[model samples]
Target chain A: MKVLVADDEPQIRRALKVGLERHGYKVVEAADGEEALDVFAEQSPNVVILDLAMPRLDGLGVCRELRGWSQVPIIILSVRGRDDDKIGALDLGADDYLTKPFSIEELLARMRAVLRRVEAGQASEPTAVTVGELTIDFARRTVTRGGTELHLTPLEFDILRYLALNPDRVLTHRQLLTRVWGDEYAEDSHTLRVHISNLRAKIEPDPMRPRYLRTEPRVGYRFLSGRS
Target chain B: MPTTRCVYSYAVALAGVAAMTAALAALESVRHIANDSMLYLLVVIGVAVRYGSGPSVAASIASFLAFDWFFVQPHHGFTVSDPAEWLALVLFLCTAITVGQLTAMLRSRAEEAGQREMEAAALAEASWSVASQLDLDHALRVVLDRVVQISGAGDATLLGEKAGAHQVLAQVGDALDPAEHGLLVLPLGAGERIGYLVLRLPPGRELSMAERRAVNSLALHAGVVLERDRLMRVEAQTQALHEADRLKTALLSMVSHDFRSPLAAIKASAGSLMAPGEPLDEDTQSELLSGIITAVDRLNRMVENVLALSRLEAGAWRPMVEPTPVEEVVASALEPLSAESSARVEVSLEPGLGEVPVDPVQMAQVLYNLVENALRYSPPRAPVEVRAWRGYGSFVFEVADRGPGLPLGSETHLFEPFWRGPGLGESARAGVGLGLALCRGLVEAHGGEITALRRQGGGTVFRVELRREVGR
Candidate 1:
């Protein structure tokens, strides 16, 4: 797999290159957003790790340009407290984001998750999926926890199914609303919150410490399964 | 006529002459009227006193005609039969005309004097209004209302131009229509047109010279008031900028020391580990690696605190409040601590205590900062307690530590930015003193309050109380 790392700081890029190369992955580097796009077109890397602040063009601009013609998974690297920019990148179709000062292990985990999602998209659909003690049957349209059926409203089931299909990926409120309730209800996050709380109560063993469904806070929700 | 006063004055002149003639005729039937033409002169003087020159002259001419035609020898005719009587009648006419002209002149002089006095009073009142009221809207309204009252305008509006858009600063009575014929637009300010006064007078009515002058002075006063307001705003802005500059300088000096120390340690440790000449032992290498990690963690914490402080000062961070469980907040707060540190800390929440409305992310940061402070101050292996409960009409939480109590008279000073406790030697655990300040900012942004008090027996307790229903 080839990974494109675009950041203005030379130390961060060098550190990432060494870390990924030691993990046996081919690493391509770019210093800014424009070069990032150029390298992305030339090398056609499998995944791109883009930084938010750069000279010439910023990360959001690059994310928008790449998403215009490419579906290659992109993860945004942003500084803490830039919640608006992170959400903007996510809304512009970036796959995921990691706040700055993150460890190499965390970055590798994000990369692997996005790659797994892409592969899942290309593969044939599965009839049933299981993560931990929770099992969902797409064909049967039912959810079971440890071999016993858990009752769910139709709307709750639909929300769960959509999240399950895109596990370990941060889905924005607009994306989820547009998919489940159609475009007319795309901005009704309050309604989405009510349904999510109900769904969490039924599925998670302890709603306080969620094991499957995780909230990204001010962004959206992420469904975490046992595997990457 | 340009004014209704002109038309009313002409009608009064005609009516006065006719009334006097009728009275003379009625008196002649009752008794012998000696010099009855004198009654006509009375009418002429009355008209001259009330109305000015033109109507008084008309009254004089009308009185002469009526007296000669009604009471002379040849009745209903302008001729006088007897020469002495005719001379007497002609003399009466001359006396009436001269007296009417003199009285009209005196009346006008008095009217002008009254007008000047009224104009002075109006100007003084407007000046006082502008000077007394610091509120620009009220002052402008007073000036506009005075303009309308003195100028006899049906309505008045003060239109100010700001950034190429016209705004109605103050309006009195009805709105002035631009299409109205009697609209008077007076531009304000001495050099540039800062604003304008639009007045709508009654149809066919125009302002007298004195009224116009008074209105102009009032408009000028409004302009001065606006200029003064602008100057005040600029002064306030400059003061705020200067204060912010001072804070930034202080922050920079303090941050540089904190940042460089950690950076220097990390650089030295990394450099020694990467050096080629000497191979270090395994234990020494491990120690160096751990040292580097510790330095990086300190730098990261400092960076977070600084970013949070700056964002708070800039008013960029607003709490996105939602209903959040207390357990979740506590869990997230503890998530960042090392396993050993987390085990040392004890968490006790009120059973059945449900959710509270707050920004979970920010609330967690507040709890984390407090808990971290408590853990840092307490002796090694001494338990730091985190408690949450429902207070009276509020949600309250406290972080208690069994360590050294707060310094005397330093309870409030503990929340000021860059305030470090004295007597602590330079060590790896020392903070940049921004954590508590950031906690206060975050809590207050949610319309909540945070306080620190010496614990009853041993240590200190940092308490935070948030409104149950955040009015956002």
Candidate 2:
């Protein structure tokens, strides 16, 4: 996979390039937003990570222009963790949003998640994912626990499918809201929590002390198979 | 039609004639002609001093005619008895007229002196009034009012450039119609037409010498005051710009120091781990990896906090407040801190506590700062307590820690940026002191209040009060 990292800070670009290259992906670096667009046209990377604040043609402007011609996965790197900046970037057709000072590991996980969704959508072929006692059949659109059928509401099924497909990776509340409930519900984390709690109650042996579905504190939810 | 004083002077002249005739008749036995003539001269001089030049001159002429008819020889006839009497009459008329003219001149000089003194005093008063007013707007108004009053004009106004356009600054009496009426525009400042004082005097009426002097002096005073006002405004603008520049520099330095330190550490550690020659032990590798993680974590927190502070400073943070449960927000804020610090705090919220109207994310930041501050200050073993309840129609959240209490009288300065308490050393107070200041900004932006106070028994208590109802 080819990834483009655009940031004004030399150290951030250097670090991202080293880390992404070490992970066996071809990496291209841009020092500014204008350069980022030029590199995107020339290199045609599979994914792009953009820093929101840049000299000339900031991340939002680039995201907007790039979305007009291409549907490439774009992840916004913002120092501002406020919901407004995230929503603005997402509304402008960014695929994901990550706050700054994030580790290479977290960035890699986010990029993988976004790439998987894009690839899966393009392939259109469904697959089943099994983690611990829970089995999610994407073709049948059903979830079962330990060979026994477990009925779930459609919303709950969608949430479980998203979580099971990206197991062991953390998802932000905004990311899940945009994916599951649509873009208009991007600012509401309360609804997401309620749905997640309802889903956990039906699946987990003890809802109070969940073993498979885990909350990453203020961030979001992650599904652990509990095998590790 | 004669003036009343002129008629009175004529009567006095006739009276003098009658009195002299009666005196001559009574003193017919001993008559000295020169002495009797001197009595008529006394009447002319008295009238000249009493009445003014016009009445005095009339008295002098009348006395001359009466003396020619009655005192001179050949009184019953139309001719003088002798040419010598003609000379005596001419001398007497000249003496009376000259004496009347001198007396009139002396009276006018005294009156002019008094009038000049009054004008000077008025000018002094105007200067004092203008000088005393420090406020530019009020000073301009007072100056316009004085200009109109002293000049006896129908009205007065001041015009100056404000915000790149010429507009009326102050006016008194009727609103000035510059197009309709003639105006006396006195330009303020050195020849540059920075401002103008305009007066509208009635047609056919002009300022007298004294009034003119007073008006001119008042205009000068007004000009000085207007110039002072302009300078003051420029000074204020320059000061504001200077402050903004200073803040930008401070922010730049702060960002450079805070961001680079952690990046350097993380970079060094990451480089060492990935170095080819480092075939290090497992323990050393894990330690290096963990070090990189910690540095990254610190960088993340600092980055997030600084961004939040900048947004708040820029007045760009518009929170979307809703009725939210306080416990959920607190739990979310505490989630990331609990495991890392190993200082778990369980807040016992009051049952049936009403929902607080707040922005969920910002409120989380507020709670996070308070909780993290509590954790940082207290001993690792001491439990941090969070208590919540509704009081006085507002939701209150208190974070109390069993740490050394804040220095006395630091409550006021506690929420100020870069303010660290006296007891904490450099290492103890990690992270820039933006946590509490950011908390205060976010809280206030939400129409809530945050305060730090010394706890009753020991330690410090941070209390945040959120209004029950949300307002836009």
Candidate 3:
């Protein structure tokens, strides 16, 4: 994946460039706002990492300017470490954020997840797909297991729709809560786990050995189609 | 026709002349009664015209006798020839003078009383309408107007100084046109020309000394009003400054409180990572672990400084003074220092160190700052010492180290915020110099003094002195 990284400090810029390149990304670097904009225009990077504070122009200013012309996925990296800065960058149309002194493992995982979502958004032409004895139709709001019709609540249908879109991947408890109940429910892991268990009972033939719903131990829950 | 004094004097002069003329006439015109009465009537008529008739009756009776003696038809005789003439002359002369005297006296008294009433009403109207305003500027304006109305001086002002400039606060009677006329200002402040008191000329009149005195009092009263208003303005300005200071303190406290959450999270995570177990890679592992511990300590110190600064700015700090043992302060300082101090910090107490009256928390803060400062300047693995000694009736606590001492002639700038060391170009540990400032503030608040000293042996020493407890 081609990625663009922007930061003012030389040390931070070097560390991020080395780490991202090791993770198999074609890394491009910019020292400030003018350079970042110039590199983005020339290279058309798949993902962009922006530092919130820079010498010539700030991250929010760049985010706003870039959003005016492009829909590329952007992640803001910052030392400000404040929720207001995070929310400001996100509201300016950037997709995600990571605070400073962060480890490489977390950065790689977040980068892949955002890239996968962006790829899927472009690949889709139509909504419904049927697999095995189970039939799913997003337009008609219907689901079947072993050719038997399964009743699902309105909230359960939304959860199933998000999982079916991802197909097979791990989703942290925080992400699942935010995707389902909302950002305020990000801390309520008990509520998310209970709902996930109830969903498995309805869809899986044997709920004990989940076919579609999978748990990544303490991390979170995942909807597994077993295709990937 | 005449004033009361002039008319009274005229009456007396004419009466004396008439009395002489009457006695001479009584003697000489005893036989000329009819002629005398006619002459008396003529004199009284003249008196009535000149003296408003009150003195006319007496003059007329006296002059009539002279007329009888000098020009009566029967000469040098006591009896009248005709009884009819005798009765007519006496009744006509007496009755005419009495009527003239009575009418003139009533007119004179009534006019004097009416003039007194008009003066009273004019004074009342000026006092009520002009003295009604209590506002300093408005009152001064009205005071000038009232002075002019009461004392009849034209164009007045109440003058004073403000911000090193002369100001005429209240000048409403007449615009005085000070630029046109070279009107001089009077300061009223210790007899120097602080400001002006202006007045213009009134047409066709000169001010009496009494009237001038009354005008001076009006200016004096204006001065009193101006002084009161200046005090009020000063009070309002002070209140606004206080409110601004209070708002700054409140904002600081709110921001500091919000920052603690993140610091708590970082500290907890770092501490857990340093726990002793389930780890490999022993090459310089101790140093990496030390890095985590140092980060936690720095975070903790930052949090503490923020909280203390917020409290200090908010005016929430109240010094609670008590007789505190010097040992307790040393123990408290050592407890925190030992946790992070790489070298063993040894504490020494001189014998007979007495209890010092001070706020315990603030005293501990002073000791803590001193200990930290000593540790920063000292070499790695060098021993640092805390000593408490009583000298000259005051308790002195000091921290001394064994390393390269402070730069010579650098005392003045060392305590400033964000200063760096000259010797060390770069180091893992760095500071913004908030510690010594806090130390100074805490020590001074408890009526104590603290200073840094260049140790003769080596390194630096920070000494703090608290007032010795008296009367148990």
CA lDDT, candidate 3, residue A117: 68
Model 1 over residues B33-141: C-alpha lDDT tens digits? 7888888877788889987778888888888888888888889888888999878877887898899999999998887889888878888888898788889999998
Off by over 4 Å in 1: A55-57, A122-161, A194-209, A226-228, B1-65, B72-213, B322-355, B380-384, B425-432
Q: Which scores better on lDDT, 1 or 2?
A: 1
lDDT by residue (B263-366, candidate 2, tens digit) is 78788888888899849899988998898888777767765776777778667787777766565566557656645453457576787774577876788788
Residue-level lDDT tens digits of model 1 in A1-228:
999999999999999999999998999999999999999989999999999999999999999999899999999999887888999999999999988888888899889889999999989887887999999998988999999999999888888898888888999988889889999998887677768767887988865456787777667888887775
Every prediction: chain A TM-score:
0.97, 0.76, 0.61
Model 2, A1-228: lDDT tens per residue?
999999999999898989999999999989888999999999999999999888988888899989999999898888645455656677677876777667788798888877877877676545997777878899898888888888899999988888777665556777889899999998788788767766876887654345567765445677774432
Q: Tell me how candidate 3 scores on lDDT.
A: 0.65
Worst 10 residues of 2 chain B by lDDT: B423-432
Sort the predicted structures by TM-score, highest score first.
1, 2, 3
Ranking by DockQ: 1, 2, 3
Strongest candidate by lDDT? 1
Q: What TM-score against the true fold does each predicted structure earn?
A: 0.78, 0.58, 0.34
Sort by lDDT, top down from the best: 1, 2, 3
Q: Candidate 2 overall Cα lDDT vs. reference? A: 0.75
Q: B1-472 in candidate 3: lDDT tens per residue?
A: 2366666856673775466565656666456343334444445555665566557666656555544554455855545677876776578666756755765676556645654454445444434534575456666566667666755555676667878976666675665544655553334434544455677656545555445545555555566566667778899789868865764564354334433444555566566567788764665465555655556556556556655654554456656666655554554455445444823677778865645677655677778788777777777778788888887877788888876777777664565433455764433334334577577767767777887788888788878887785332
For model 3 the TM-score comes to 0.34
- Which candidate number has the best TM-score? 1
